[model samples]
Target: MLGQDPDAAQELMHSWAAQLSTRAQAAAELSDRVATIASSAVGANGAVRVTVGASGALTDLRLDDRVQRIPGAELAITIMAAIARAQAGLTEQVSIAVHDTVGTDSETGRAITDTFARRFPKPADEQPDRSERDARDGW
Candidate 1:
């Protein structure tokens, strides 16, 4: 068949190469987007704000003047809670990035999402319950 219809096989190979290139581009785009992702959370009636990067590392923490009213130990707890809450959001943010870039149904998408979910799972207690969010929102 090589001599009978060589063009057919060449065309098929071209199509496969093109598909592979497209997928590689999509995966690179997804990686770029995920790398730039940052998630944040507020706690303690807006006294504390925490931001975490794609790796679930604390990139920023903000404490309002109201933090002065909170006891030292309590403020520590609030900040820690906010950090966990922020980390928990990393999975959601990555999922959105993955969906937008590669689609969640893809193997790459599922792997990336599952890794993030496992690394930054919602804190054991899912810190910052309804009351904490309400306070942060001034409710």
Candidate 2:
């Protein structure tokens, strides 16, 4: 018992709950985006691999099942999206498969782009400010 006021404890719990809900919603959306991106990658049996370090860096990334020679733009977009998701505290793995072979790598590129668009969507006009939170909430 920290001997804090009971009302203060209730406020702390409420703030904690609100913060957790916000994070959970963001993470869920990011997960859905990951799945969409992974399923849309253009390659033969493609997979989007992501690795994150404890410090939250884009530790490692791979696409199309380790195959290289894909367009640099495509790879960059995919890697960037994975990094974004990781930086947002989402999980570190996403996979997508492009079933069409007409363009192969190019199609995969398109798929990756589409996934990025869907995942990143337009940013909200307004965002919550962490500085406004109560100190007892502790994020």
Candidate 3:
């Protein structure tokens, strides 16, 4: 279906991705705001780290150290999901690491891991074949 109407598909996908990114950015902002929850809980003692970057067709998310204690995983998952949901082209890859300032619980890791794993699946049309279009359309 797309080979016969490549331009149309590309345009549709582009528009869809743009909308998704915009929404993801909005959601990122919200999640980032809440990301301080865990760090704040530890007051002056704890810190949270979050990094989000583009990795091919997926978004690479890393949350580590003291940040994992609060809402680090939740925030990371939120941002990842937002990006994956908003951008149809994105597949999510979220990684988390935590250090114990107080103590560690097995459930914490499981919870965050589960959250990342259980996020909603991406839609099929989100991953458009852009290679041919890039060569032909000069996009």
Kindly list the per-residue Cα lDDT of model 1 for residues 15-54, writing each as its tens digit. Answer: 9999999999999999999899899999876678999998
- TM-score, ranked from best to worst: 1, 2, 3
Off by over 4 Å in 1: 1-4, 124-139
- Cα deviation in Å at residue 76, candidate 1? 1.5
Off by over 4 Å in 2: 38-139
TM-score of 1: 0.85
Top candidate, metric lDDT: 1
TM-score of 3: 0.24
Cα lDDT, model 2, residue 66: 48
Local accuracy of candidate 3 as per-residue lDDT tens digits, 1-139: 7778989899999999997786566446434432432210111122322233322233233434544444555545444443455332211222223112111244433454346445534444432222333456885
Model 3 misplaced regions, further than 4 Å: 1-82, 85-94, 98-105, 120-126, 129-132, 136-139
Error of 2 at 86 (Å): 19
Each candidate structure's TM-score, on Cα atoms with residue i matched to residue i, is 0.85, 0.29, 0.24
